[model samples]
Target: MIADAAKKLRENIQKVIVGKDEVINLTLVAVLCEGHLLLEDVPGIGKTTLARALAASLGATYRRIQFTPDLLPSDVTGLNWFNQKKQEFVYRPGPVMS
Candidate 1:
């Protein structure tokens, strides 16, 4: 079942990201192994593209957060808003939660 899902994902991702079959395969392997993949290379080699493609292929929710000097943890974690009707602070699920 997982293999079928992964094949479907790979096919879907190929539509947008051309070539780089090795990267895509490795990404899928990492995902299946329950391990994280470290793709370190020079810029413009489709690192972000590969990530996005894999996310797209899996039919999974995708979120891209840029790490910068002004980026805050709360920004990624989302904020709690008080609901007047409920009279309580609601914890909004962040991108990671998705």
Candidate 2:
């Protein structure tokens, strides 16, 4: 059953990302293991495309964050701000929440 799902996901992602069977398989493994994947490579290598395709295949929301040395935790996890009109705090969700 899980294998079927993985195959389907791989096929669907392949419609958008080609010549990356190994990467896709590794990605499926990571997802099945509930682990994280770090894709580091040169530009225009379809890293982002593969990510988006995987998310789309799984019906998951995709959020892209430009990580930088100056990026803060709040930027990824979200932050709370006071809503002057409501006189209360409002939480704004960030990429990690997606």
User: What lDDT does each candidate get?
Assistant: 0.82, 0.94
TM-scores for all predictions: 0.72, 0.94
Clash count for each candidate, listed in order shown: 0, 0
Off by over 4 Å in 2: none
In candidate 1, clashing pairs total 0
lDDT of candidate 1 vs native?
0.82
Write one digit per residue (lDDT tens) for candidate 2, span 1-98.
99899899989998999898999999999999999999989999999999899888889999999999999999999999999999999999999999
Where does candidate 1 stray beyond 4 Å?
1-5, 84-86
RMSD to the true structure for each prediction, in A, is 2.6, 0.9
Best by lDDT: 2
Residue 87 local lDDT, model 1: 100
